[model samples]
Target: MLVISSSCKLCCMSKSLTAWLSIGLLVALTNNAVSQTSHPNIVLIYADDLGYGDTSCYGATAVATPHIDRIASEGIRFTDGHAPAATCTPSRYAMLTGQYAWRQQGTGIAKGDASAIIQPGRVTLASMLHDAGYKTGVVGKWHLGLGPAEGADWNGKIAPGPLEIGFDYCFLIPATGDRVPCVYVENHHVVDLDPDDPIHVSFKTKVGNEPTGAENPDLLKMHPSHGHDRTIVNGISRIGYMTGGHRARWVDEEMADRITSKAVAYIEENKDDPFFLFFSLHDIHVPRVPHPRFVGTTAMGPRGDAIAQTDWCTGEILAALDRLNLTDNTIVLFTSDNGPVVDDGYQDEAAEKLGDHQPAGPLRGGKYSSFEGGTRVPFVLRWPAKVKANQTSDALVCQIDLLHSFATLTGQTLAAEAGPDSHNLMAALLGEDSQGRDHLVQQARTLSLRQGDWKYLEPGRGPAINKNTNTEVGVAPQAQLYNLRADLGEQKNLADQHPQRVDKMKATLGRVRSESSSR
Candidate 1:
């Protein structure tokens, strides 16, 4: 209107274009920020051989698990939580892979030299989180095997392990505390080693010059109760034989502190970014050696003392979250790999000095059984930002359901064929609804089915009680059934009384097993 020049008009037009471009960039960035909000940091704390009645939150009076109990009090606790299997390796296999461990031929209680049970490139819980823009790590007992079927080279690089599966970092016990090479494997190699003294291992034969527990009873501080009399390390015998790598052997009593320190460090490093940490605790398991600091925290001897130590580890993890200022955005899940066992393979006074300490509580049997105590374990979850504080749910959730459930929480969709056995129970997990697993298959030597408060056990051929463990195997010649609502201890055989319910459950279990996948 004021008779502007062409050059001035072109300048104004360019400035207007720049303003619009800035607005577009801002909108795109805002969308990206919004998308990232759903992916919260997740920490899955798995305890080894912990039972439903082991924690004070679950009504154990022998020892109080304040740290573990806090998760139940602050977020949500499930009364009927279970592992996929009664033993460690199979249960861990099912938990990570979201497939029944029995589906695979080799998924048993793995030896120290056993190869990788979980094949790589398959979607695991860690891999799923990795794909969802989270850094993943696993610390502590990794008994699900490592390397190839031919076995791992203790001195050489260990492959096909946690790293190959999904984790960005792994500080593992390799097989277990009672297994051999008796060394810590961080990522792909032993944590500390002297090349001059290379390690050798074999589960099938005695491969070392080291004195066996069978031969060196005088040298042992804790004698083997049964099968664990192969290799001697730190005055204790393990299940597998190993020679050399003497410098790399771990001290049983110091394991809790050493493992917890590494886990805390991981949280510190990943505080700024979303991460998924699988902190597996080797606590209250066999060779029940509690840290000296927590030596006699309970009246029930080493097993109870170990429980106290386990609680300490839980407290350490929580403290890390708070120190890093990640508590509000972090979700912590606490559960065990399997049920309880008093005397698995060691003479740790776990069975002898059991003075009113109920590790299995109201459950029928302990570890290595088809009963409720075998698979049922303590489970608690906490996330202050998303989950309301101090809530409890009696949802019948299983560890196998975590893979799909977490995917949902992060707004991710698993492939239709993947996570076949996993159910999306996020609403149940968060206490948003009471709906949980309609049914879950419990595995021991045989399989059983649980649907709501009813359960059916198949007739099997096994010892009524395992002599070494002295645990009732829940085995019988007849089909056993129970209404858990009426018989929480699983005493009464209601199968003869309720035939139709047994038929329906038995049929459902058959289909679940016969199918290629549960999905």
Candidate 2:
């Protein structure tokens, strides 16, 4: 009821408006800070033994990889991407450790019962991401070995494994499909294992009363062409011997479905928080047994059918991201451990059914070789929030650089001793830079060097071609050089013509080998 002046009322109204504007400004600033600081979820889909031309996006007309193609179409398809080595174990080791496998002894292809290759307390990609407040998980092939030097206790807890190395959770295939103790290791224990049955495995000698493929040829549904003829499990011959864990043994055909389901579930579980999933797929490798539904999906036999199954697994992961509305803020990377091999061990009609299909495309070698086709694989990166769609990159990118690249992405500073060989190629990885590593070393039976468009293969003593798999080994008594720009197939040897360049490259390789750290 007290009368007030018009000027006083106006002043009161102005002050109230200023208070609301200040609150609004503070909220807007807080939201901006969160948007800038929030990290993206990362999903690395690693394909085992998948070649440059295995996917439809990479020019594989024989087999259609629609899901893989969708990733490439939606993001960047790299034409000059590579694994660290031509072999599985070394490639995986280098990728995770950020150090070349050759730098350490006993880093070669590990046996089924081998101890953990990656020691505890080492700062790995998973560990680095985990420190940045991300839930890291790994599912499928973990060929880097497990447990201690004495070996893993199949019935008890398996220590110094993925859990110790920074992965919050792990569902491992133990080794490869063609190897044994062919059971899934969930974190510390063997999945579905019966306590009474126990478990025993040996690579040095046969164990248990299980019939071997060598002794029970009549019982095998798939016969080995070479060294994978020891233990027989699920009607297929394996490399190592294993006994017990009968209920824990996985069905080969159902592996894709089982592992894919686990990967999807991990994504769903961690939807509220930033997560990193290493979806390591085991497909198109030896003993290529696709699910019954995908058996006849491809005309290229079991090998092609396995590729189709791999595509389905990729699709499942993409669908999970979509379902959770996490597509935009997730980084999906699709690449292979190494190049392809048609006849690794089992007689799966991979070679016989391969008509005009070129697994490595125009490249010379596959799997175990120093050639372009060996380490160079299909690489695609999709991030709807950052990367533009339908782009192609020829920048020389290698998997070994991912550790440092991701560290940079998460704004984490790596210790000087950590990730010694890993380069910060985040610019190249995000497609912001056109050039990646200036020089890269490719490992096979012999080490090779790639500098710009030139390739140098050091002199080594070995067979030029693998007789068992019929793949070119790329070994020679003298140094070999090639100008990859002019000769993509590596048909012409330019070492004799470019002796100076060869000598320079040789010196560089020598230096890298002698040095403790490349970064």
Candidate 3:
């Protein structure tokens, strides 16, 4: 109508199209960035007393841990992985706080009535993740202790525990299954506790009128081989004494099912949000009492049967993730607290029925030993979205580094004083790097250092062998050295041959001890 030319009309139309296309491209790029930066759900499955050779994937022919193997086949299996210590309490402590347990006094094997080891104000793995906008929950063994300096009230609220330390929620086995107060504590109170009955526990002296294992041997379904002979609950005697709270006490056979159910429920409830789950399993530990359905499933008696039970629990969790379509964005890690111990306390035919079954595989010593088997444990990590499948890594990874690694993953800054011993091995964990921690410290009754393939053990004063458990404690009157590449079992002592190396390692150990932080 205004006598405009055809070329002018075409130019205006082309410009309009280009402007619309630019807006569409901008919106698409923004969406892609948001998806990339979104945090993934983390699930850490911690197995108690599971050794490097305990699973079929790790070469245990007697036991087939299909569920554990599935994780291995799906992600990365670390051969040189280790726990923080050879003992339970120390290992758990280091993993959570990112500091070596040896730095703190009273971090020894906790009694059933021991006070809280981790204080409220201190930084913890859960606290760090929680601050990073993730809902954290720990469901299973929490042997780190509870209550205040005076100890927890078994009948009332147990304060200054997992909740105080930054966990949004907790369902815990206050101590080891073999210890007293053999009940589950959910959040702050003892689950299913009866107010009228009351509860009392003691490690020093006999408490209550409960019949002891030493006195009532005939009443026990499984007798103690050594020290676990105090309070009898559910026909099994445990370390320390406990009275009342019968309703809250957990049954030995039904424990696997009970705890697994709770863990699964937590995952389901928190599926909508970015969550961190610490699913600590109580399997293949002492007093290995598998359910009736799993009793005769293996030839290694209760121990092998318990391994099978552990696999089932793993399957349950995996199935839940699959059902909820959360598998792709979740990172799952499976590992143990320490090495294997065959007759820890109860008489469970773990030794006698053993036929060609090697718990620690080719590694020497176990549990409380200072040898390779003591600290070296099975570690598998799986992240379907970001990690490649069927990978095996020999990176020198330790549980202590989890705090710093996770902190890096969430893009949070840690205080200078926090995670003193923890290193950021995130690249190694994700299989992006092969070398992890040039040198690592392994703790048992004494301390040892691992630099590359060489190992150094400082001379310490203790029995060379644990007489009761029939295990090598790795104590001696002289310094010890070994090249793990040539001698995996630590059969050859090359200390005399390599005097200079021993001196260097000894000096390094001393330096580490003197320093306030190793990070």
Whole-model lDDT per candidate: 0.89, 0.92, 0.92
**Pairs with backbone N, CA or C atoms under 3 Å apart (clashes), candidate 3:** none
Candidate 3: list runs displaced more than 4 Å. Answer: 1-38
State the displacement of the C-alpha of residue 178, model 1, in Å, after optimal TM-score superposition: 0.9
Model 1 alpha-carbon drift over 4 Å, by segment: 1-37
Tens digit of lDDT per residue, candidate 1, span 1-519?
689899999999999999999999999988855654578789999998999999999999889899999988989988888899999999999999889998889999988888898889999999999988899999999998889888888788999899998899999998888888689999999988889999988877888589989998999999988888878898999897899998898999999999999999999998888999999998977778888889877888888899999999999999999888888778999999888999889888888878788888899887899999999999999988779988888888999988999998887899977888999888898888785988899999889999989999989997889898989888998899999998999999999989999899999999999997886
Give candidate 2 misplaced runs (Cα > 4 Å): 1-38
Q: After superposition, how far is residue 405 of candidate 2 from its true place, in Å?
A: 0.6
**Which is better, 1 or 3, measured by lDDT?**
3
RMSD of each: 3.7, 2.3, 2.4
Tens digits of per-residue lDDT, candidate 3, 1-519, equal 588788999998899999999999998987754553346889999998888899998999998899989988998999999999998999999999999999999888888888899999899999999999899999998899999899998888899898998899999999899999999999999999999878899999998899999889988999999999999999999999999999889998999999899999999999988899999989978889988999989999999999999999999999999999998888899999999888899899999988899999999999998998899999999988778899999899999999999999888889999999999999988999898999999999999999999999989997999988788989988999999999999999999999999999999999999999999
Worst 10 residues of 3 by lDDT: 30-39
Q: What's model 3's overall lDDT?
A: 0.92
